[model samples]
Target: MKQAVVIGGGVVGCHIALELAERRYEVFLLERHSRLGMDTSTRNSGVLHAGIYYPADSLKARLCVEGNRLSREFFDRTGVQYRPSGKFIIARDRSEISEIEALRDKAIANGAEGISLVPQDTVQKRVPCVRCVGALHSASTCIIDTGDYLTTLKTLLMQRDVHLLYECPALAIDGGVRVETPRGSVDADIVINAAGLYADEVARMTGLDDFTVVPLKGDYYCTTALPLEVPVYPPPNHGHGTLGVHLTPTCGPDVIIGPSETPSRGKDNYDIETPFAVFDDSLRDMIPNYEAIRPSLREGFSGNRPRAFRGGTRCEDFIIMKQPDSVIHLLSIESPGLTSAPAIARFVVKMI
Candidate 1:
């Protein structure tokens, strides 16, 4: 049996550990925190995207599609709460109609189905609160109970008899040589760095150069009311280091207004304080219904996205690079990352 180590206990790390365990590799999962998914994975919008967005050729295009199918199947088998609520990309004005059409074409190119251009008249009758000249409707989209999904993955890992070391943070790494916290060290033939928030530090410790993990905060607001039955999205903001705010409905049927774009200055910045100014100008303005929506009238929270410094990076696919000699690093894994979790894990396991 080959001994391997996976660092980081988030969704990617835990899911990969489960895959490795299935393949009979003696796997040890090391997490700095006491529980799994306690970091960035837990702090995200539980969106199972419909394989829209992104150019057809990218991994975001491929992995997202594969991940969505596989994750949905897994959820069914494991009894995780996942709902295919469907979503719409609304164009509030004629200026966005062209872009919405382009996205429909792109989704087709990416091998996605049921993506159509919805007329403004239909939008007025179906979703009057949301003003739009046109909208892209993708029926393949769904939302998952991310918390329940993570807990299930953790339970699966433990049931497999895989070793899990909680509160055991890695202090240093020289190749496969790692000096973990307390009075201990570990050497293994394989090491995977999926430390969502701190994935950059894990990579640097292995002596690889030329990469940085920029933390982008995505704030969310929640309401008890299932205001709009379908999720509402706007034409994405076409700007560097920026992203547009959208609305999402949770698995429990509550609506979430959110994921505001707030870039982080440094590590350990898990601040959830509401940015009243940004929220007022951007979130409320981009999605007009937010002003009078029932979700806006309820409680909410925020999460962080481990994004690359540039906004273009978010549109790009998740980065999984192996050192060739040894040590594999998964960087800037955000957005559809949760949707791409299983496929990403399988890809990394094969690389190993």
Candidate 2:
């Protein structure tokens, strides 16, 4: 049997391992944590992006559109819990209407399905609490049970007899064929580095150091105050790092808000450091009746985004690099990553 080793056990790593195993490769999945999806996978908003936010020709746009479809199909086949609750990207003022139009056009170019521009009155009738001049309704956007999804993927890999080593961190790599882990040295014909935050460090081990992973922290708050029917977002932050603070309906009763973008002190920093007032201001701008639920807000969770930077500029597209010696590295896969995990896995295996 062909031997393969995959580092990192997040959603992307797990999916890649599964795909390789299906192709008759002996796969060894390494995870630093005791379990999978403990880091960037399960944290933050679990919304399956509809490929609307990225540039038209970017890898993120193409992968996200394909991933959305593949993910929903996987969830349906495996009985994963997810709500096909659509999304509304609202324009707060006339100035932002142009932004919405641009996003709509980009969505069409990216081949995102079930997209349409809705008038303000239609939005208000469905979600009376939200205030907007216009909205881009995305019927394909869905909220997923992230924990369940991750668990399901792990189980599927296990059923295929893939070796899953937990708490086995990769300390070094030599010649792109052997990985030095704390437990022992693992040798394989092919090595895949899907280490989320430490992908740059992994790349450097193999003498490929062209980029760095900069960790950015985003904070979330949960509230039962808003009667929102679906996920709602403002226009993209443009050049900024986030998609702006907006409301998202979860699989549960609580609605989540405020993933305020801030410079992370470290990769493992998951504290709710940002004050509630910042979320309060952002919420007030999107939903005029936010004050009614201001008192109901509670400290939720925070997740770090492993943003990739090359030559001191933020890389907006996902980077999948293949070294000459049968080593593949997946770097800077942030938002839409969870949605695109399955498609990313298929792409990675095809590279071999």
Best by lDDT: 2
Clashes of each: 2, 0
Clashing pairs in 1: 222-300, 241-311
lDDT of 1 by residue, 282-334 (tens): 54544556555533444466567776533333425577887634577888787
lDDT for each residue of candidate 2 in 206-279, tens digit (9 for 90 to 100): 98888899889999999887898789899987657579998998888889996888889999999888877789
- All models: lDDT? 0.76, 0.91
- What TM-score quantifies how close candidate 1 is to the native fold? 0.90
Q: Who wins the TM-score comparison?
A: 2
